[model samples]
Target: MARAHFAYFHPFEIRFSEVDMHGHVFNGRYLDFFDTAVTGFLVARGCDEILSVDGAGNGVDMADAAAPVYFVRRAGVEFLAPVRFRQRVEVAVGIARMGRSSLSFALEVHGEGEDAPRACGEIVWVAVDRATGRSAALPASLRDKLAPALLPQDAAPASGGA
Candidate 1:
């Protein structure tokens, strides 16, 4: 609910189509929401600068001479709660760890509830050379933009309880 120093905050609006026959967001559809939010999540931290888009609306890699950056892996996903139709949500993202060619992310989704998370998960991404198709070092520009992901912060303290 509060801004976290180590986390990048991203706000998302729930779409009407995200709902399913049951009148709630469909199980499979959450992935799409998560993904869209993730891109925005990256963009907020200046990651959009590295998507390698063409002069047109596509990933033609005009920035790196046709080299594409891809998500080579995923660590895990922990679902916390279901989101109903049109509920506004905020995605909190932070890097759990970083490696030579990868960065691990921890994501949390917060809704209009009084307490608790709507969803949360961890994702690991590897940098690969589009030409070689092999893992490569993350570029300096991207690394600089994602510098916030490298800071270490403590967890939220426990609240009052019996």
Candidate 2:
């Protein structure tokens, strides 16, 4: 759990379902947006899609691979701005560290180029043994693919990001 940060970027759109009674995206929806961007970033880096394969094409053939499921063990998020209906946003996701049983990420969210982040968060990932659903090492090949995208800096550890 030493610090080793690596950064990445991806884009998304705000949807009506993501909003709350206040007309702004609900606090929880940000996490979904964060996941969308992170998934996209990892796919671009050639990692097997952990969640789905429909949009990532058959190159990695996620469905045919020995997929390892990851569970969020911890997260730390800071909301800096509000996102309203129909706004498009982009998030930058970075790995701040990698450990034997887990990995850490830094996420920066923005309204697609407004010069300021709408939010920033840290995410922690741990591979789980599919059958037992307990902690395990991230698969070596997948780790190799994801390693190149780790942020070039470091930060204090955050336990998880869901």
Candidate 3:
């Protein structure tokens, strides 16, 4: 896919601690990268409050029954090339689908100055009622805030209910 398709990009330096014995970044670390980039993307989109504790960084009170939260329903990554320590990379993030109770994101990890992505993946996050621990329809406010990041219709994932 073309880089132009993505509207948000989060860059990072591959840290030595993330490398495995094979000299490449550990396979598990990609999920960390994806999570970080998605958080950054949400902040850039002016949805930081969703991630903050009362919007004050005080941290969430697990006891709050009404607190909103999202649970990861699925995640998949496809590695195309090895990434070494100290390499600069960026993750391009785009919302591929907005279902009644979930959001699906498409992500690509690209090396600096590279035309192709080193990896590509998708993550599905489902909004859930904290008290019930069940899927809940996404709030209109949150959906509106994230709508701008949706991929163009032609490039979006195949339609289906989440």
Candidate 4:
């Protein structure tokens, strides 16, 4: 995908701790990179976290909230190339789909100064109630905030109207 299409981009330095015995970034580290990018995205939107909090930066007690937090229902990543320690990567995040109680994200990782992505992935999250740990509907506040990142088709299923 073209860089212009992404609404958010974060640059990350590959830490030595993330390197594996194979001398390349560990496969699992890709998920961590994705998580960091997502958190940055949420913070940029004035939220502490997705599915909970009012973006106040205060650590709210999710267990007592009306709706708690988002739980990752599924995640998958495709490694297109290897990355070595001391290298820097740029992560581009985009909202792929939003539902009543869920949202999907697309992530791409590009080596610094490179034009093509070295890795790509998708994450599906579902909002869960803090108390019962059951799924809950998404609040309008979040939907509105995320609207700018959604493509035309991606926004269709996210309509709150019954």
Q: How high is the CA lDDT of each candidate model?
A: 0.64, 0.70, 0.83, 0.78
Per-model C-alpha RMSD:
4.7, 4.9, 3.8, 5.9
TM-score (C-alpha, index-matched) for candidate 2: 0.74
- Candidate 1 lDDT by residue in tens digits, 23-66: 77676665555566667667666565466553343665456544
- Tens digits of per-residue lDDT, candidate 4, 11-66, equal 99999999999999999999999998988887786655452455566666544467
- What is the alpha-carbon RMSD of candidate 2 to the true structure? 4.9
TM-score of 4: 0.83
Question: Which candidate leads the pack in TM-score?
Answer: 3
Instruction: Tell me the deviation in Å of residue 26 in model 3.
Output: 0.7
Badly placed stretches (over 4 Å) of model 3 are 54-67, 156-162
Among residues 3 or more apart in sequence or in different chains, the pairs in candidate 4 whose N, CA or C atoms overlap within 3 Å are none
Candidate 2, residue 85: CA error in Å?
1.6
Score residue 52 of candidate 3 by CA lDDT. 60
TM-score of each: 0.74, 0.74, 0.86, 0.83
Candidate 4 wrong stretches, greater than 4 Å:
49-56, 62-64, 151-162
What is the model-wide C-alpha lDDT for candidate 4?
0.78
* Stretches of model 1 off by over 4 angstroms after superposition: 1-7, 53-60, 66-68, 113-115, 151-162
The per-residue C-alpha lDDT of model 1 at residue 110 equals 76
As for candidate 1, its clashing pairs are none
lDDT per residue, candidate 2, 30-74, as tens digits? 778777777777767766466556454554445433455788888
Q: Compare the candidates by lDDT and give the number of the best one.
A: 3
Expressed as tens digits, the lDDT of each residue in 36-139 for candidate 3 is: 99988987787755686444445665333564688899998888889999999999999989999999988888898776788888899998897788888887
